[model samples]
Target: GFGWPVIEAQASSCPVICSSNGPLPEVAGDGALMAPAEEEEELARLLIQAIHSFSTRSELIERGLANVKRFIPEKITDAYIQLYTKLGS
Candidate 1:
């Protein structure tokens, strides 16, 4: 399954720090800073960076807003429709 929290944060214009596991990378795209799920230190570093650096934060916000568009209701519906059409054929 996809990471809905990542999409929600992106839509909310909040910076994201996510673990590099499962579908998180695909879900986050270029909108988030990711660390290995077991690497607490690295995740902390990314969290600090997101909090302190204005440029990084702004970039995350910008990219997140763009990345979130991929999951819009219309797009998801269209994708499902396409899949079902292909299956039906």
Candidate 2:
């Protein structure tokens, strides 16, 4: 399942470094730096990069804010309703 922490981090104005496995990459969009699942070295490198650079961090925060727009509660509910209606039709 897609987790809520990704959006929460963005909502709090924090950049995220998470795994690209499963829905994470799709969910994160361009908002996060994603490492392959179980790749500790890559994840560590991304963390260091995010931590040491101001511009990159800022860019991620900006993109994260933009990405989270798709997941607003009303928009999500409407999408589900549309899907269900289409299926019923």
Candidate 3:
């Protein structure tokens, strides 16, 4: 029902540590640290790593923000216009 929070977190340059279920993986793309769904141990381990590993977390956050920005209205509109022009040709 909602995936915007994931995107927003990424946009704020925060790496997401999420349960590996639902549409979170899809929405997070390569910009998240996912743990096995319903597996507390795995989730805990990944979360710890995400929090403790500064470099990896920073990279994910940066990439995620960049990826999310690509879906912004202005950028999407520009892309649509380009596609339409190409199709019209």
Candidate 4:
């Protein structure tokens, strides 16, 4: 699934701490910190970690900005165009 919040957070330069459920871990990748989906305590811990770790927050913002580039509208369109071109060949 396309996780819009992840992208939005990344694009907005916010630190993202997400659950390691579904495509969140895959999509957020290294750009965001994670907690196990079923563990409420783990989620709280990660949130607390993010709040206290200035370097971690900065790292997330940096990586997230880079990750969001792949989802830029023009970039996605380019990928489709490239795929169609390859198929045409």
lDDT of 2 by residue, 9-85 (tens): 98888999999898888888899999897899999999999999999999999999999999999999999999999
Candidate 1: minimum summed lDDT over ten consecutive residues — where?
1-10
Those runs of model 2 whose alpha carbons end farther than 4 Å from true positions after fitting are none
CA displacement after TM-score superposition, residue 62 of candidate 1 (Å): 0.6
TM-score order of candidates, top first? 1, 2, 4, 3
lDDT of 3 by residue, 1-89 (tens): 55888989988888888877888888788888887788999888988888788898888888798779766899989999999999999
Model 1, total clashes: 0
Candidate 4 lDDT tens digits, 1-89: 77889989999999999988888887787899887888999989989988999998999999999999888899999999999999999
lDDT of each: 0.96, 0.93, 0.84, 0.90
Clashing pairs in 3: none
Q: Could you tally the backbone clashes for each prediction?
A: 0, 0, 0, 0
Please tell me which model should have the higher TM-score, number 1 or number 3. 1
Which residue pairs does candidate 4 place in steric collision?
Answer: none
How well is each residue in 1-89 modelled by candidate 1, as lDDT tens digits? 77999999999999999999899999999999999999999999999999999999999999999999999899999999999999999
Model 3 spans > 4 angstroms off? 75-89
Query: Candidate 2 — what's its lDDT?
Result: 0.93
Off by over 4 Å in 4: none
